[model samples]
Target: MEQSFPALPGQAALPGLRHRLSTRIVSLSLGALLIVLAMISGTLWLSWQLEGAGAAINDAGSLRMRANRVAIELARAHAGERHQLDAQITGMDATLARLRQGDPARPLFLPDDPGIRAQLERVSHDWNQRIKPSALADLGVATGEAPAYPAALAAFVDQVNRLVSMIEQENATKTTLLRLSQAGLAAMACMGTVAVIYLLYIWIILPVMRLQDGLQRMAAREFSLRLPVETRDEFGMLADGFNRMAGELEGLYQDLEARVAQKTAELARHNRDLAALYDMAALLNMPNDSEALCRGFLERVMQQFNADGGSVRMIDADHGQLHLVVSAGYSAALEEAEHCMRVDACFCGEAASESVVLIEDLSKGAALSAGRPASDARFGCAREGFPGLAVFRIETQRTVLGTFSLHFRQPLTLPASDIRLLETFGQHLGVALDHLHLSETARQLAVVEERNLVAQGLHDSIAQGLNYLNLQVQVLEDAVSRSDMDETRTIVPLLRCGVEESYQDVRELLLNFRSKLAHGELRQAVEDTVARFRRQSATELALAFNDAQGGPPLQPEQQLQVLFILQEALSNVRKHARAGHASVIVRNGRTFSMVVEDDGEGFDPMEPAADDQAHVGLHIMRERAARLSASLRIVAARGTGTRVELILPR
Candidate 1:
């Protein structure tokens, strides 16, 4: 027999219910499946039996008819043979006696009696005494008919009579079998009717009565109602099982009654816990100011968990040590100073390092393990750390942010209730941290974006005005040269140089503000820069840039840094390393290198220029390079010329 069982809760109940309700259902369903199979098999068997019976009956009838016809034809053949024998045995007087004894008026066929022995004797004499035996028979064979012909007629008549009698008897047997088949069919029909009545009582009425009673009782909340155990068969089993289930249901009803109130209390407690967890998470996630959040969360945990003390400790990621940050329910002195102890010495430290909760009994030398006596020091005796505790690791994406521990003064059984509550709080705290991180990022981005907008505004507006001013100065100078434009002539030489200087100052302002003006390809922007430089300086400037198209495009802020470095270096070349022919070549070797080489009176590259010297441009260039994480190298010797190189990370 196939069997099944049911699964219970993870924590074992250890109940001795051998047959669970689920097993009952499975058993019943399987039995039903087997019953259906039996029914189908029985149906098929009955159909086969009936079909076989019909076929056998039809076959028997056919055979009986064939036998009757065969027997009748054989009898007729024997009769015809007897008739042919008459002519050969015409003088046989025994034939008349045999015919008379066989009832000729009624045309009945019967064997000849002893009174007809004449024919037998005659036939024997014809074949034996009437002639010279074989020699006489051979002579007769050459003459006429056989001598024993009349004797054969008696045997032929007997054979014909036997055939007719056998035929009649075979027909009578067929009639008896047909009568028996009808009687058997009637008996089967009666049996089938009785079987149906029994099935209706067992399958329908009895079971329905039992089920109705159970339903009525269940509706009345009398869950302990039971049915009678009638037999050990399926119906009996069903009754016994139903009663057992009812008993279980009664117990379940009671359990539900009690559990409802308990669950209501539990739900209320969970809600409170949820609120507390949310509050703690809010406290933890408020700010990345680790000191404040840890302290606040630690205090809340101590109070919320109803623990004697709590602390949030951080682990030494490298040394595998622990450091207590926020501790509550301890001496203010210890908590304030942020007491330091090796992970091996501190209780919380050791607990965190071990990655387990410490539940000390605090008997004998248990407190002395930390070199503290096992008595309440506050009560003028040694006091140990909390008796029972739980430690949880505060872990995040990159590092174990810290560990939090709750300490109970007494040995407390830490229930799953509090554990789940605390874990949910921890999760919410983690989410809060993520939100804070996003806020910080958004703030930083806003600052950067603000700076970029400010830079662009100054470039587009102020720089354009300066460029126009510089062009106007040049136009004034050209007009003065072409003709005596008196007013232009008067002001041109006096204001011309100063105007150009003013334009240069504005250009410097624009460069600073326009650093964030990137809206297209970086190299194309660089090309534009080169073109602008050539236009502004109005000198032969050899510009070359290698890999200018390939470096990760610099941010607008980084672009501003690059532009400043360029401006400062080029300004220095113009002022100190003066050369008619100059080159600004951007070379990317190990890093991005920009070198401005000019042929001019050279100076020591390492030493600063004299106080009176015009190397302030160089100083500014170096400062800009420092800000950009770029290296500034000044190569200048007496008359060989100079090269100012600015290098930034690739």
Candidate 2:
């Protein structure tokens, strides 16, 4: 398809005419024309010779007539008409001269053959040497002295007959040559036209077709096409140009394709990284224990990076040790050895100093690359037959929480994106662990608060009851010591009523202390409290739960506070309110609100507690409300029922 234009060493140089296609076509056309013209000229030359031969033949025949006239004129001269005889002899000589020397204007000539010329010369020799002189000498003598004029005339006429035959023979030969030249000219025209057309096709048509095909291929994005440069002409140059352009376009297309592919791969990788980060974040956010969370995270990380072994460790800052929270694909021995390393101890410790440590080829034993101490113990990952390792610090913005590691079975290099993603995973793990710690701390704090409430309740209700019973017993003892039967009956009934009232208070306190919320369902906890309060007391209680504003649920701690506050309010109604009926309404929305109303002989809002029970219960409810960062409003009057409403903001 492709060819070099310049000739190689020792090769024949290309013809200069080859460079100019038009010139070559013109030259070929002209050459064909020249050949046809040459053929035509040859035919015309032969035809002209034949034409002159016809004239020569005609003139030679006339010489016979003229010789006859000269004989007749000689006879007349013998009859004493000598003047006409001279004129006749002059005309005959002139005819012989005209036959000897060819005339181009009349187209009269003989062929330049020795035999024809000799025949003509014989005719003229007899006329001048024998026939003419005899006639002339006889003309000068008597009629009888015209010696053998008739014989001489017969001889001359025979010689002229020989000359005319020789000229006719030469003319016949020219006619044959003329006919052959005409045939050759016709053949030359046909052949030359065919040759010219074939040359034109070879030089022009084929190259143009190839160029057109090349253009079509290029349009189709087939840049690899190369046209053959068969000539050193304009088409050859065009072919060369086409080949160069195709090569350049092919290179450009390949480069563009490569770049596009590279960008596509990079985009896909970026999406994968983002997906992994999202999945890791979602996994960490689930309500799981720290150990389970770490184990799940480590497993996912291992799967993501194709790690052979991995571990998640948490820092025990109090003891300055790292507790191995979770591990996978590691030997038991290695796990045991690395389970409780000191914070300043192994690869994890080193990683704590550097956020991420990627030892691509751990088999190289390049311990110093991560700036580890020379005296430090050998890495557990290396001991586990992992040839490559990556260590990431589990850290937040404020502190280094722990470290996690991935171990590869073969030497592996992580790209920057992978390293950054791993580091992000570590940060997510650290945040999850921190959240778990906060949740545990909050649980502990709630337990302590519950214990304090229990103490306060016992102090306010049970202790007071026990103290009153003791006084009643002392008085009854004194009355009994007096030994009056009526006094004993009165004191015994009073003691019995007092003991029953104290027993009821004790039962209610135990029930309140045992009250617990199930799974932080604030509405369910409130309904349960209201049901319990209604069962325990004579007050008819109706519960209404409304969550029309639909929003996110409260935190565990917040739910607990709401539940406790509701319980305390309900308890206050049962003990101090002396209400006939009560209503509890719980509403959940962007904010949470609970209202506990009682139709009872309500106490004045501005007055002092008047008793320990009312003051302690009211104080505890307010305290619980305050813990939720909510407001508690108590509406009470001497005649109206009491209404306690707690409101918690978003």
Candidate 3:
């Protein structure tokens, strides 16, 4: 038999905890208010009963006194003392009327009891019939025959005494009843107060204390604490809710701890992957031959994946063939036989053609190793003695570089994480190869451009000077052929001067080609050139550099070009422009500007004379400026000074 337990109180109660709590609070307050109101009503009723009893007692005493006074007045009148007998009679008459009408002033308090009314009626009758007549007679006003003298007084006193006794008895009874009612009400109110307090402690105060204790425990991270659910009320529902919340919080905290641990492990794994990739990149960047780089990369891959052997094979796009660049853990005969394969031949070739990773379980005896000639070479699976193989494509954005194949002795299954690592490694290798290729191409281009610049420089300076020297020699030859002695002598000195000038030009060209500014410091080079020009020329040179100490430094190539342009401008100024003041201003900012000005005999730049030596210098300066990716502007006139400006992007 399955034993069942009762459900916790108010676990699934309707209207929720808030509504139930409000209802309970309202009920308790109303109950307490009703009890208080009942106590107040009981006290008021008792007071009213006591007040009526006191009034009745006082009326009884007054009735007795009035009766005694009537008796005294009757006695005095009988004794011939009738001075105030009439006044006494009137007073007694009024009291009798009040008793007969039951004191109409107290309407809700009528003396309607038969015994008391009868007694009061008798007193009134006696006073009117016997006492009044007797008193009137005594006062010397005869209306009727007077009755017996003290008999009427004795009857009236007896009746008044009876009425007083009845009134006292009623007062005593009411007093006792009022006292009992008060005691009963007080006792009931006290008992009710005790019951309400006990109930409040059970339903409200105890639950509240328990909730407070639970909250304190929760604040201390004791999420397992719970309140007891004892009744189908607000407190019980609250306990249920609190227990549920604690359970959920405990579960969530445990789950959070688990997730944090899992994520930490994942992060550690990722860090190891990154460290390995960084090591591979450093190895690839070293100045090693292609075969050495491949060999090192294969070793790392084998170590990273716990594989037995691996090979890096590159695709010859033009030949449509796969050439094994490097290999590991293979016999010499097998390596020679499998060193190269066609693009569509085997698993590696398939990976290259499809540009996807390929896996093969050689233990299944698949056809991947087919079509190979049977020989002692033992190519493919037979040669490698590996049960499983994986081939990954090494590619970039659009170009397929090659294939990397790894062999495992046992049948291997790759997890997503390991597969992702392999893919990332392939990407890094492909990009590294591309960078090396680009670097080699750039080196070759740089060499070719340097050779072209040297050829042009020689043609512009040394070759031109030699041409002039040849013309001068031809003139000396013509003079000697004519036998003109004076002309011949004149031609000889001109020839000597021409030879010296050509030699100097050759020297200067060699110096210009060989000159290498220290670390390509354009400003220092400019200052040194200016000092040299000042020593060699009569012009006063002023150099100004504004905001040139900040901003990004220019590239080495750009700085060299700017230095060369400045040197050319100063050279033209020295040889042709006989200026007194020359200034060079270089400003470095978001853009670079170099201004070379001279106060000299300047010529129109737009239409320079064909024989002007400055023209060649200006052409060279413009060529250097073009290489700097800058624009050159020359402002010169016959009379005005010359200003050359070069603006380059920073």
Candidate 4:
């Protein structure tokens, strides 16, 4: 008893059947519209393209005709030059014939013959210095000047003939363009036929088919059905009118689309803003590390635009310098993408000067007005990133802090929304960077406070202890019996030694505490030390300093560490490697290295480190080297002598 009351459904089938018939009619009509529209549009577009192509062909043909005339002129010019050469040769032949005649009935009238002789000499000189030199390979003379240079002249003639043949070949190649035009014309004929067939479908066959389907569906009493295609001309106007009638019957079918699309746009905007906020949040958390934040900004810009090469160009407008603050790029694309400029010079400087964004197509465009575009290829993608590049300036109300750039391997237009996203990213990044700078300033203040506390503690505790100990030692010295000379002397020496060691430790501690002041002047100090040592030394010492600078300077701790290493090296040279001369060099650069060479008794450089006493000097040098972030090298042999080297990287 599943409910068997289905007999009334027979009437429902009438309505359903009519609906199906109407749907079929509408489907066929829409299909006819799409098919005919595509054909008509494609045919018209292709015909227009072909017309432009034909015009271009005519222009090319005109150029070809001009080139052919130019070739003929070249032929004439060559012939004229040839005649001039031939006349000189014939004149020479006539002179020889006269000389062979041996009719020297006089001095051959030497001066009278001078003019003719001079002409021959002049031709020969021109050939030797100019023509013969151009035909040097076949001259058959080792020297540049050669008489009777038939070999060279023959070579020149062969070259001219080859050139003529090459011109003929070039002309033949150009004739291929005309053949192309013929092929194009044939193609045009076929295109016209396709265009006519397309027009026929649009005007007649498709319309008849649509009318038949519409009448059949109407006969089924499906008044809700109508033609689905709209048209533009007379036929289109009729079709559109019919479609409007259909829309009336099919009420509300496409109405929901507009509302749904608008709703989607609202949702997408929220998501985009959310994503941007999340990116900004990550930067804000890393307040102390400005470099990380800057890199993050660079990475986001890279991600947003798919950049291949980029840099931070800092503002330096006051002094004409667009310093490349920081650059990131791939190794392979370096030659194309690298931005190398002195710290005091770059387009970023101008950008900062005017406070504007600079965009350039280095491959195609020239520099601009608001800022400098140092051939945009400076921001070009590596082999991996090259199709194009883009730049953005990071700015705020305060000033133009710097510029950023984006690059892509292919040309692309960054959409308006994308540009807005980039601007937002840059603005937030600039703010984050500003925060980082403030944090660093705070950190420095904290460090100063701590150092002051340490200084006060040293004065109140360690110094007072030493003072009290000194007073006790003085009292002990005064009370000691002078007559018990040996005992008094022993106590005095021990006390004096203790005092001296304490003084030395205090001096070292003070120096270490003052390290912050030496920002990047280590090499100058090291060089000064070397110079002083050289002044005292009797031997010659040559320096090859690698000029490393602008990096964080060596702290007082590091300086002391390096000083100990030098002392150990000098001591080793004095005791074990006995020699008459020595040289110490400290070289520095982007990376620091040093060599202390001496011509003394040499020993095997590669030896066991466990032999502590034999390598006492080595141990001291290496220990000090490790503390200074340096390397110590001992080069020695049994007889040839030894060279000690110490390299410190600071």
Candidate 5:
């Protein structure tokens, strides 16, 4: 769930910033530097022009003095003064030429003014023509030979003075221009400095300050705050980025509570589903009959689904019928009427064939109002005032056991999650029902086996005793018919003994038949049998029992068989072996073992019995041991006690 930054209207249509901050600052600095350089260059040029003006004025004044000196030297000319006159004239001509050609190396050049140039030319001409000729005319002659030298020299001095004044005036003008240029340079420097500072603040510093303020606000969790995009620079992009981030954060914070609430609801529903599943599994594991298990399952399921009524119906496959095993929130008459239904009957039967069936608004009026073809076919649920019904198949992976129907008081539609949960519950019910069927089958098999054993016991003991009584009576009848009193008396005693023995056998059989392993407690049954045996024989009997910890306990059938074997062994010891002492030892360990021992004049266990009746108990004991999948051994020798030992399988 990534969202792009929202842009302002028409923002995308704008062009990028052409003159970035860096480019503008660099341009401003370079312009300021160029202005300063130009100002300094102008001032230096003015100073150079003014420099030569002062030297030109000094040269003009010297021309006036040199002219006067030449005139004096002429007036005083003698043969020795002739050389002095010539030298003065030559020095003046040199000065004139030097001024005319200006010395650039010495920075002595005339100003670029028309008036100053004319003055300099006049000075050079006067010195070279008028002063030089006048002075040279009388240089080699007598003193009187000089021609009006004093007057002419004075006129030439006046001309030189005028030239000096003009040079001074030009120098003054240049000096003024130099001073004004310096002032302008100072002003430009000050202005450039201020401009640079203001530009830097506007371009860099101001934006930076605004960005810092925005960050502080953001840090304070003010997500609604946004920075204005003043310029299209990097800082502008930063502002945009910050605004986008704030929008996203605000959006997330706004919906955070809603998302958390949704997650909490989902978690609560999940926990509830888990608890329901655990409770249902526990209910199925209970050791209850099919009817009770189904009844409890229906009641709990109805409560879970918030249904007004519900019923659990099992399929009687052989009869092609659905039998209602349990019902809740239903009228007694309705329960009785709907107790049994054919395979092709109503919603329950249909649900058995399918996985699920949901029927809403089953009322006759609503169905007819909806104009449905099956409107008139409204079933028992509609008549029973349960308009809404949901039927789920109770099924395993391999088979469908039956259907459980939930009846709603009002029209209802279940959500997918609820429907899924109901299906899971149906599978659980299917498994439980299957287990109940298996347990019932096993109980029936145990009953049949016990009945057969009882019949066998009756035929082996009581039946045999009855047959012997019949033979004895026949023999007595023969003796009585012959009028043989001696034979009759002997027969009569035998008959009483035979009848007494038969009665005793019948009682023993009855006792043995009634002996049951209550609650599958083998040890208790053994103790009771041993006590009965001791009382009957008036013999000293000891019973020892030991059960090791963590031993695998015997099943009910195995325990019952073991008890019967012990009973048979004790009976044999009491009736046949005239033993003074007998003991029954029982041990429960990795394998169960029971031994019944007596000290009596014992016979060989390997020898064949004289008749079937004599060894019937032993045969029966061996049969019971075989049924337990255990080992049975009879240890006996002459003049030693007999020991019957039974060891059951692990």
Candidate 6:
């Protein structure tokens, strides 16, 4: 079995199976630390060497001073001033001894070179052999011979000067060597530091960065990505684990995607079902005939279910037979053959009788062909050569309305869900058909009621006008029989006037029955009416419309009534009042108001006798206004002009 490794939390797994990163880091750090320590040690050693060199140079300078003092003492002795001559000689000897062998207490300069030491030995021998003997002889006795002592001392001082110069030169050389060593140590330290840094980058930083990049890709759901496992370490194990996790996640995502696709297909099917039922409901609501509605329903069912063809068969209650009202995607021969059938003769009819749905696969030829003769090829649906059929009974709560049949080219067994949806569709179709039937019945009733109203109106207006003219004619005949010329002339005009008035009443009634407002616009119709009257009447007619707050208040029927009232008022002004000017004012506000006023000979409105000819016009206006739920007021006196005002609430 292969061992599995779990990744660490908050940090990537270390490469533990290979060289430990910590060890490498510690080694690099220690290397750097060692380099630093070596640099410090080298610096200290160089500083010490420089200090020693400086001390040597200073001692060599002191030796030169001692040599000069010896020369000076020799000069003084030669000049006969021998006061401290012996002391100066002793100091020169002591400085030479110190130069030859270094004195720790005085810290005198000494050279390590053999050549310088041999030169120093020769100088000591020269000093001791010649100059010292001369100086000592000068200090002890007269010896006033100026006995070559100054020349010997000068030679000794020159040798001491040469020794000091050699010591200084050696010290400068050592200082230069120390400085070079320090510079070399510093360069080595810097190079070591750079090498350690480069090692650390290769060993730790680069590997950690690669692991971090792999983690980022995983976080972003790039599961197909894999980290390179270049070592047998913790990072390598983590890469293996990451690859495993990515594989698992990829597998899960594929499964989830497949499930989502399946669900989407199901949702799409449900939506199509809903949309098909909605379209069928809309077709049923339309004012199409039964055949058109059936055709639309069949087509929608076929398209929604992917059927090759379909038919709707309605039962004719009178004939007690099934009739194919509409079909889609069927040959003409098949359509004609299946146009009509007995209630118990066909599959659709059988489904209608049973009031249940049936699904058939004709390719099996099992239950469908039971008890059928071999030579009887007159089957309705069989002639179509369909592989499958689904017949659903469309029925309301009270009655079975029809049968819906779908035929498919291939054998198909509908799922339970689809069957349930089809059944629901059928039920909705039945309900819609019932609603349409009720609406048609209501429409017929409305027509009958409107005809009754029209008949009543004719009886009240035109019939009354004819009766009045008949009475006037009887009076005219009586006047002619008496042979009274004046009475005859008066009766003739009254008779003629009655005939004209009756004629005007007939025309007005006809116009009222036939005239309809254009597009149901009350204002435009009123304007047209005023224009017509202005063209015909001698009375100067004016129309004023004021509807600034709201729109027109009256409905189409109410507007028509108002128009008729206006016409009656204008006719009265033209025939009876004989007015020169008349105006119609229509104002729409919170309430609607129409006023008709005329500047003419006004009559007493309060004393409108039943026999008055103007009374008929007033009656008609009052009746029309009452129908509108409005108030009609006739304001007039013996001399004042008449004003008819009609007001209705909005």
- Number of the top TM-score candidate: 5
For residues 494-539, could you state the per-residue lDDT of candidate 6 as single tens digits? Answer: 7677677677667766776687864448888788778867766788
Q: Candidate 2's residue-wise lDDT over 1-650, tens digit each?
A: 33335766634344455366777877787887788788788878887888888888887888778777767776666666554767777887887787788899988778889999899888888889988888777766764553666777777778888888887888888788888888887887788778878888898888988889899989999998988878777777678878988988999999999999999999999999999989998999899998899999998999999899888888888999989888888788888888888877644344345567444466776643455532222345666688777777898887889888888888768888888888889888988898998999999998898788888888777777788778878887888888766877877787787788778778877765666555547777777677777677888999988876786678766877777777777777877778888898888888888888988988897887666565887888888887778899999899798999988888
Q: What TM-score do all the candidates reach, one by one? A: 0.36, 0.62, 0.59, 0.33, 0.72, 0.49
Pick by lDDT: which candidate is best? 2
Task: Estimate every model's Cα lDDT from 0 to 1.
Answer: 0.56, 0.79, 0.73, 0.53, 0.77, 0.72
**Minimal lDDT window, size 10, model 5:** 368-377
How many residue-pair clashes does candidate 4 contain? 14
Q: Tens digits of per-residue lDDT for model 4 on 253-332?
A: 35555667877886797587668668666755655465566677677667655677566765555764455555566554
- Please provide, for model 5 over 1-650, each residue's C-alpha lDDT reduced to its tens digit, 9 standing for 90 to 100: 32234558634322243535665667777888888888889888878887887777777678877777776676666545444776877888777777888898887766777886787677667666776766666565555454756657777778778777877787887788889988888888788788878878887888889889888987898889988888876677777777888898889877886898988998898788889999999999999988889988998899998999998888888998889988888888788888887755544223334466444467534432123222222366767788777777898888878888898888767877788889899999999888888888898987887777777777776787788889988998998899999999898888888788778878887887776664548777777888778668877999998976456667776787787888778777877789999998888887778889999878876788787666777778887888878899999898898988888757
List model 1 lDDT by residue over 301-344, tens digit each.
Answer: 77887888777776565785667777777666645444543444
Query: What TM-score number comes out for model 6?
Result: 0.49
User: Which stretches of model 4 miss by more than 4 angstroms?
Assistant: 1-263, 313-356, 360-387, 395-400, 474-650
Worst 10 residues of 1 by lDDT: 373-382
lDDT of 1: 0.56
Q: What is the lDDT of residue 537 in candidate 5?
A: 85
TM-score, predicted candidate 3 vs. hidden true structure: 0.59
Q: Candidate 5: how many backbone clashes?
A: 0
| lDDT per residue (tens digit) for residues 1-650 in model 3 | 32223555645544444346566777777887887787678767655654554555465556556656656776665566764656656766765665555442452232446888777777777777876676555555343546354456676667777887886677667667667867777787788779878978877899999999999999898987777777766677678889998888889888989999999989998998998889998998898766777788899999998998788889898998789898887768667887887766534323334443566566665423333222222236544687677777777886878878788888767776777788878887887777777888898987887666666556655676687778878887887888878998887787687677667656655655665754537767777778877876789999997755575767777777787788778877876788999999999888899999999999887784787444778777887888778999999999788999999976
